[model samples]
Target: MQIGHDAIIIGGGFYGAAIAVYLVRQRGLKRVVLIEREPALMTRASYNNQARVHNGYHYPRSFTTAYRSRINLPKFVQEWPTAVKQDFTKLYAIARRNSKVTAKQFERFCRDIGADIRVADPALRGLFEPRLIEKIYVVKEYVFDATKLARLAEQELRQAGVQLIYDTSVTAVSKGVDIPLQVALHNKQGVQELLTSQFVFNCTYSGLNQLSGDFSGVCSGLKQEITEMALMQMPESLCGLGVTVMDGPFFSLMPFPSCGLHTLSHVRYTPHMHWSDQRGIDPYEKLRGYHKETRVDRMVRDAARYMPELLKAEYKESLFEVKTILNKNESDDGRPILFEKHMDLPGCYSVLGGKIDNIYDVLEKLDEVI
Candidate 1:
């Protein structure tokens, strides 16, 4: 069977849901349908992330990404006031050894980006190990409750008159000789076709390669990796604050406001292993899923070096998700959101964002394209 729509979004994550709302409400586009393989939105990488609404401090190495984040941080807060947590203070500490940026450089970077940065309070400063950490600053960063964000997105999509289809996957995409594009969707029933009207957005995240071979064959810009995050309980003193040790193999322990638990994620230790599709083989082919006990042990062990309090935290669980990252000049640190319009195929667009707050950048770019 073939279904027709004015616009079809291939992913129903927060970015895709936001785009669907924008296209229908802001652009006055009717007959839009958003399809997702999962039963609900934000269950994948969107929900299984660090949840920090980044404000340039995390990516001092990439100025474009940092500045874009700084620009969008407030816009996101203003738009989703109910979904974000700003009452808690966020502390960013620079690593003494294997540091990416020095104390002066980090301060200058934040100042240049107009980010609110200052020395941590003397009482709060003692929480980190002085030997491993060089400097700590209180930055303007907050965590977004993915559950609240998803609920808000669902309401927005509904009010915007978007037809959201869950438990559906876009297995194949092909350009029609006469029609704009033909998408093959699979589910429990069988395969169905969706004929779009000259505009289609591929927001499938890690499922990009599964949708089209051309993305990996001709366009060749995206790189996929399996990443993990560990969740644990936090002590009372650390409940109202979030801490991150910068550079090299460090960790970020932040309170998950939604569940009242803390998440400890190590930059280099959390991901049990990472394999790339660009390595002449597919990584997901060999990998099954996340190993909870091993990854959690590594997370607590590595995080203990900076915050010994993590040693007392009880292990909750670990989440594994396929992270779709942009291959920017062979560097894995770029966070600039990617929105490719008809790179290899007309009437088709691919969207991949690094940070959640960068959703504004994605919407702005989509408005320009649509």
Candidate 2:
């Protein structure tokens, strides 16, 4: 009963943790080891996700990572029916004519995947609260509860009998003949090396460069930033356009079943943190001049420009947080990389670059590899 495992799952976030659960349930691997740098699971990107179960609204722009991920999300959400406390009627996506994927392309996207979406502007309820957007006409779509999905996944993994260790930090990893991979961690008892089996599932967002003896490729090169905001009233659908305005950047408005919240962010560059292997985020102190404030202001301001209602809405300072993300693209082959070998890494894998929209897809991959 007390043994390493057929898998060594690195990182205790959504993708890694969920893969551990799926491997145990689907592959029936009881003896397993989980290494999490944080004191608990899902303290990373998983918790920082938009918490929106994206409705396959953003699909394959030439089979891009975002598009490819669209294929497996429904199953991911269906896996945990109870964890999901909310989902919108539909997901709306709007794009400016000059964007990478245009209106016509988006329509074809709906037809290609048979994804449930439409071209009409749905009423904003909840934070969808009756607003000034009544007059603005922009291409719109919807998304779902990604955070809920993660919460559900965590519950399911536990029910399926998986042991998760938190507050444990991985100092290094190595591979040899007798022990294919050795994961050294900082536990209460002091430094200890875990002899992991090969099937290592790495769901560590922005922290995948630890594998040693020829697995350093696990850490891909890309920058990521995530900012989360909670909105009081919510609506049935999320609508707005992914656009590049005068400043030349991309932005989107994400609607949730109302974490009693909402979020807005863009995939851009900032010289904050490059390497994903850093620990403990630097807390921001200023109300408006801080890092969190800068990011949120950028997000909400862009969203307000897209959705007219967001322009006049009163600001509520009590509901917002910034979550750093794995910033990169699947186009340059910058996806999560993990090495799987039974008795080699045990249950271990690496989740490289992703958003809440694509993490579920990564989980499914871990299931098969493990």
Candidate 3:
């Protein structure tokens, strides 16, 4: 079967869905179809992440990223007020050794970004080991409920009349002789095709390299990491609080709004491993021989050094997924959203973003392209 639309958005995550909504409601483009390989939306990196709406504090290494996040954080919260948790008091601590940012540097970065930051109470600082943590600050950052956000997106998409096609994957993309681009899609019904009038947006995130394979040298700078987000049941006092250690090989234990639990992720101890090639990824094949939790004990051991309370938390299951990150230098830990327009074929663009709040940035960039 063959279908036609004004635009075809690959990957029905927040980025793809938001683009569809914008095209229809704001841009006046009709017949936007969002395609997702999963039977549901936000099943990959979108749902599996820490869900923190970055407020410039996470990227003390990248001032541009921190500043941009500070600008978009409020926009996102205002857009989906019900989907975000405003109750949590986020705690950010600078590591005493091997930290990426010094206490003063981090504070300076936060001040420059115009994000409010204050010292953690002296009594509250007693919860952490003095040798492991040098300084702590209470920052204004909140976690979004992934499931709620997805639901809100669906409602808005429906209201905008955006066609969402789940359980469908784009198998191939080719510049059509008649149409601008022809995208091959696969599902239970079998292979099909979609011809777009405007352009094809590749918002597949980690699947960008795989989806744009036929376009040579398009996603060459892309890399993938097999990362794990450990879910733990913590005390009530820590339920809504978020904690992240600064610099180096540290761990961030933050509230997971969707599951109502805390997610523990390490900077050095996490990332089971990273794989990068100009070619596409086969995550299942790559992880076939690997046990997801084999190294989780080590992660917990390392994280315990900073937050001893984590040792007392009950181990719930872990969510493991392949995260797509830009291949950048060590000094540059910033995650700037990537937007590649027409790598080799016209009327086709590939997009990848790290954080959900960055979706606003993605939409603004798309506006200029359109």
Candidate 4:
């Protein structure tokens, strides 16, 4: 079938939006359409993720993929318009712990990329707050508010004339490399067929397997619920400071002023205690409260650490959120898996596994492949 759209992006997250923008803006493709399941785009893995534009330090010392990723991210960030300035991001991943990496190492990594950073002494630990085990250097970068970024993409795409279909789930994808591949999408209409230029980018992080590429990693194995509470006052110091944490397993802090939830930060992964996707098995409940006693235990522990005096202060409202977590990460291979593969079909291509920093570059390559 000669398709209607020149390109149909499978998921409306950063990669998908970036791909759509690239196809239309850079490649001059007029018929671009983005299909999204959520009423608004960027609601899945991309939306819930910490929006740090990593400066390559997260990758390994000599890893080749890490080196390439580091080299590529800056070029991608620079592609954004002045309105999406490099500094638009609010949080930075400051690597400091009395552990594997040190302040000097972080500074060296920063210098390699010309990334701005502040070297600090262990005595000024509060400067890095929460994870202030020792005074260390902080490498800061503007963090993209995932939600805001998603919404921004939607508006920009619409204004630019990219047709966007929301609240529509892609039930089945027909893969091929021909001019237009027929895709089976299921939504309120039940089932329908849409043809697009065979170049399909499956930026769907959650449904990689569904797109025909078999990724060994599992997103459903682990889960997370981020509970955010505002500090009594917005500390002038913690605005953009974030840490991997001195005392916990993979603890991180990111501040968001754009979301208006900037008073404090949110926490993830409280030890072995795990949560679930709460898959539709339980009807009538959009959310699941933690097991009563487990909830109390976590509250008490969180309160004591975040606010020692929380035992006295009256608690306010709290919102519990859930998402899939990938616990099985290989060491120092932190570079997101970005690849272009055409499954058994001839015209369809799927792009998978990329971080925000490398999104533009990924799309550039994706277009070339198509």
Candidate 5:
């Protein structure tokens, strides 16, 4: 049996949901459907991340990414005002040693990107070891509440009349006889169904190539990592502030508004292992087979060298997810969004973005396509 729609989006994460809503509400397309393997939206990479609303300060090495974040930050905040958390102070500290970018260079980069940056207050600066930290700056950045954002997405999708299929997986996709593409779906009950649409969007993050089969070439040059983000209750002194030690194997302690805790992630310790997609390895299967252990002790011990107060953090739990990135950007730590159109399979597209606000870039590209 076959069902037809104008478009079939094979991911219910933020990008897929956003695309579905935009097609119906903005583009005025009537028949749209979003499919997800999970029972709900934003439960995977979207919720397990650091939840940072990047404001150009985190990417001094990548000018294009920093500038794009600077441009999109305000628009995202304005569009989702209530879901953003701006109560805590966001601080970026340059390491006196072992940092790729020095304090001066970081300042210049921020200024170049037009990001709001200023010397942090004396008290906040004093939180770090002066010998280890060369300089600290208070940057205008914000953390998002993914739970709230998921709710907002649900509301918008409902209002736009999007049909949502949860707890279903897309096994394969191919050229359709009548439509532009055909998608084979497997649900929890062991039932198989076929869906056809004029357009098919593979916004499945780590699973971008999973359903493409022979057309996987269009989603090549991808990498996936099993990453962990440790959640902790901050010490009283650090409760109202978010801190990041820059440009090296350092750590970041940021407010996680969803649980009223802080997420601590270390550059060297966060990713357990990573693999390139060129080998056709199944990332989700690898993630499921690997054991997950909390590395908060190592993170705190190393982080305490720069900020002694980190020793007081109480580890609550860890959030594990498959973090995906474009293989080409691994050198400079760049995070430009990946928007690929498949010429072999016309009307099929694959989308991936490093950061949340990068959605604007995807939307811009979609405008030209759809």
Candidate 6:
């Protein structure tokens, strides 16, 4: 049996869920549905990672991404005020050695992007080793509670009247005779179902290009990495502070509000392995087959070199997910959202965004099309 809908959104991550809510609430689309392989929303990439709501400081190298974050930060915080965590002091330290951007350069970049940045207080500065750290700046940034954000998404999606379908996977999407697209779905028990929709949105992050049929060649120049973020109980001195060592092979430790622990990630150690999606490899399958080991020790050892207080952090566990980014971004480390409209497949669109606040970019592009 085939069920028809106005819009069918695949992959129920944060982007997919947000898009579904936008279509139904903002656009007033009634017959909308969101399908997720997992039993709930935001269980994958959305929950994993650093859970930071970027405020432009993180992207000193990429002006566009930094400015974009600056633009979207307030909007995200305003829209999801309940999920935003602003209780901690956020600091960005410039490494004196082997750093790409200098302390002055980072300060100038922050000011250029209109981000609020100030020199860290003497007390906060004492947390880091002065010999290895050149400067520490207090920045206005916030980390989000993924669990709260997930609950908010579910609430908004439900209130917007979106038909939520969980525990089902989309096998393929093909051109339909009656409708614009036909979606083939399968459950864990081998149960299959067909759904037809006027428009289909491919919001799958890592699996953006994995679907067969009309989705082929829709997205290109993509790369996926099996990334890890170690959660740890911060030391007494670092509990209320989030520190990010800048520019090169550095590390960041910030509050992960959801679990009441801090997430520790390093520039050199966070990404275990990466592969190009252009080779037609499924990232999810690669992640499933690969064995993962905890690199929290390496991360802590290296991070503690810059901030000696990190030696006292108690390691809890690690969150691993497939991190996707544009291949061109490897050069400048810029994260611009990818929005593609398939000319071959009418009423079909694909979206890939690296940052959570970049959702506005996706929503803006979506407004242009639909």
Off by over 4 Å in 3: 1-3, 212-214, 217-220, 284-290
Per-residue lDDT value at 65 in model 5 = 92
Runs in model 6 deviating more than 4 A are 278-280
Tens-digit per-residue lDDT, 136-244, candidate 5: 9998889999999999999999999999999999888888887878889999999989998898888889888777443555545888899999999999999998988
Q: Model 2 misses residue 145 by how many Å?
A: 4.9
Q: Residues 259-365, candidate 4, lDDT per residue (tens digit)?
A: 53332223332222344433232211223444412232344354345423333433323333333234433344344444545545454555555467667457567
Q: Which ten residues in a row have the lowest lDDT in candidate 1?
A: 278-287
Which segments of model 4 are wrong by more than 4 Å? 60-98, 104-116, 121-123, 126-132, 175-180, 189-191, 211-240, 243-250, 262-329
- Comparing candidate 1 with candidate 4, which one achieves the higher lDDT? 1
- Candidate 6, 99-178: lDDT as tens digits: 99999899788778888888988999888899999999999999999999999999999999999999988888889887
- The window of 10 residues in a row where model 5 has the poorest summed lDDT is 211-220
If both were scored by TM-score, which would come out higher, candidate 2 or candidate 5?
Answer: 5
Relative to the true structure, candidate 4 reaches a TM of: 0.69
- When 1 and 5 are scored with TM-score, the better candidate is 5
Residue range with the least summed lDDT across 10 consecutive positions in model 3: 211-220
Give the range where candidate 2 is weakest over 10 consecutive residues by summed lDDT. Answer: 239-248
Residue 298 miss distance in model 6 (angstroms) = 0.9
How many pairs of residues collide in each model? 0, 56, 2, 13, 0, 0
lDDT of 3 by residue, 1-370 (tens): 4556789889988888888899898789888888898888777778988888889898887888888898899999999999998897899999989886899998888878889999999766877899879999999998989999889989998899888888888877777756777787888688566554557888887777665434543543877788887888987656667898887788888888898888888877568888774444565456555677645677789887887777777778888878778887336788788888875778788887878888888888878977
- Candidate 5: stretches off by over 4 Å: 212-214, 217-219, 278-280
Deviation in Å, model 5, residue 360 alpha carbon: 0.5
- Candidate 5 lDDT score at position 1: 69
